[model samples]
Target: MKILFFDTKTYDKESFNKQLEHYPEIEIEYLKADLAPRTAPLAKGYDAVCGFVSSDVGSETMDALREAGIKLILMRCAGYNNVDLEKAEEYGIKVMRVPGYSPEAVAEHAMALALTANRRIHKAYVKVRENDFSLSGLMGFNFYEKTAGIVGTGKIGAAMAKICRGFGMKVIAYDVHRNPELDFAEYVSLDELLSRSDLISLHCPLMDSTYHLINRDTIAKMKDGVILVNTSRGGLVKTADLIEGIRARKFFGVGLDVYEEETNNVFEDRSDEILEHSTTARLLSFPNVMITSHQGFFTQEALAAISGTTLDNAVAFQKGIQNGNEVSA
Candidate 1:
């Protein structure tokens, strides 16, 4: 089976090349261009196409892929909100993804973001580099006994709950389907979690019902000086409302590894270019707010797992074996 890998970065190529030797049946041609309508045509001679989180795999791109005789889409990452699953189904394109690459990798990043944002480490790092060692604005509260709210109880969320418990924090979670093994977390309602949590970390998926879960009304419900961190889907929080919350001093510190406007800037160095009407630019202008390029699942372990599983998925599809990674609309 031949695959057209799209939106590939240096790390992607490096990791995938290491795994390619294991799967001699699968062959991949890497391309820097993202999988969009225009680039989908390049997959005409390939069996399947691989894309990252930032690839545009909507109806138009699916149309082009269908015309190109492509039948499978392999998402190396866990999240598939960027792909139009309904359109892919209509086009007879089977979509598969690595559901859980390395839960500990993402959970560790979430903990790092929460702690860094709460303690103003990002700012302190810059000040100390300039030989200005001052503790004027670096004052932060202790997390030993604080309440931590986790939005989802999946593998990653469960890992986060374990980490929070290790910090001597009270872990509370709100999920539609609760995990019985997540005994450390006290299950609660969303409103109660929002109101009671001193540190809130989002770990939920992005769906129509979960889109904009953190908005103006939800932010108003959170406690004052609460630290907000998101390492999950970007669409879960409303960016404009988050800016408003920051302006109103609702959050003590905000750390986001994902945001609504990240697609345009993901893995790209736009440092020299001036963005016009960019929400990401607005988000970056604030000192208390921090954002990463959706790299929560970027650990070496996660990358190796993703590369192995993606090729396994392609091999399974070639043999008409349903390995349960198939995603449906």
Candidate 2:
């Protein structure tokens, strides 16, 4: 089977290429452009189209892909918020995703962000680079005996909770469906978690109820000087509200691997160009705020799992065997 991959990065090509050796029957063509209405026609002769989190798989793009005889939409990442599931269903295009690819990779990255920001490790690295390490303004509280609020209790969230527990922290979580396996954490209301947690980490998906979950009012509900970390979907937190919260000094530190408006900015080089988004620009000006380019799932283990699962999904679909990874509206 022939597959067309969009938004091809160097790392993506490397990982996929390494895995492609195992699937000799599958041939793939890579493109740097993102999948959208304008580029959907490029998959005219391909059996499937592989996309990432940044790809625009909306109705128009799905329509174009369907017209081009594309039967499968294989997402290489866990999040499918960018995909129009209803359109895929209407077009008879099967959508498959790597649902859980190394939850530990993302969970560890979330902890890295929280620890890095909380201890001001980045600042200390800069100071030491200039041979000036006085340790002033680098005071960080111990994670032990602190309250950690996990917003979701899925595999990733559960992993994060375990990590926090390892730090001797009290773990509290807020999720619609509580996981009984996560007995280490006590399930509580969102408001209760917000008011009680010294460190709040978001691990939820982006949905109608979760969009802008951390907004103005929600930020107000959080404890003052709380450390906030987000390694989940970008839209889960409002960038404008987060900036406002930083201005008000409501957060002791903010570590973000994703942001609401990071579509074109993330995974792209814009160092030579001026930032168009004022909120993102203002966020960079703050000392306590650290932003990464949505790289929580960039680890080797996660990439390998994603490539393997994505290929397996494609093979399963081609064989008309429903492996239960197919998604619908």
Candidate 3:
């Protein structure tokens, strides 16, 4: 069984090779390309193609893959929004993904973002480096006794709620599909969570129903000076509405690991050039906003788990095993 890994980075190669050593019988070859329609011809004779979050697998690319005789589409990450699943199913291409790698890695990053943003840690660190460590504008509130609203109760969201509880915070959660395991965190309606929470953290997935879930009306229901954190998919929060909320002082701080328009923007080398997008440029102008690229699941533990599971899924699919993470129509 031969596999063609697309969008191969140095870390991906190193980590995948190390993990795949456990299965020495399988032959794996990697191609380092964006995997669009133009590049799909590269996977000529491979049985499966592995892709990352940044790769574009639209209808054209899917058609190209079908023509290339590709049977499996293995996604290293959990989100399938970048791939057209409907078209892949239509073309008889089986899709699989690593559903949960290391929930703690992402949950920790979300908490780190919230803490850093709320306390102005980046600005304070810069000031200290410049020998101007005055206490002005560095005042931050205590996390204890604060109400934290968490959206989604998946593995990552559950971990986040536990962390918030450890900080002596009262946690309230809202999820379309509630997890019975998250009994410690009180389940509340979206409006109630927004109305009462001092800090709001989003950990939901990206689907048609969840797109731009946090818009102007939702922001209006939030507390006067709420801290917002998003380690989930970018499209969950409306960027324009968030900007307006920030300007109006409805949002005290924002810690984002993703953005609404992040295609070709995040995880790329653009430091030498001027940013052309006005929304991104404006988001960076605010002192209270800390925007990190989508790296919430970039820890070593998560990478190893993701690589191992992805290869395992590929091996299972090739061997006709009953895999749980297989994508269906």
Highest lDDT scorer: 1
Across residues 14-85, which tens digit of lDDT does each residue of candidate 3 receive?
A: 998998779886777887677789998888888888888888988999999999999998899888888888
Q: Taking the tens digit of each residue's C-alpha lDDT, what string does model 1 give over 8-67?
A: 899999999999988888889999999999999999989999998899999899999999
- Clash number by candidate, in order: 0, 0, 0
Model 3 Cα shift for residue 5 (angstroms)? 1.5
Error of 3 at 28 (Å): 2.7
Would you list the C-alpha lDDT of every candidate in the order shown? 0.93, 0.92, 0.90
Error of 2 at 203 (Å): 0.6
Worst 10 residues of 2 by lDDT: 275-284
Clashing pairs in 1: none
- In order of appearance, the predictions have TM-scores of 0.98, 0.98, 0.97
Q: What is the lDDT of candidate 2?
A: 0.92
Clash count, predicted structure 3: 0
Cα deviation in Å at residue 214, candidate 3?
0.7
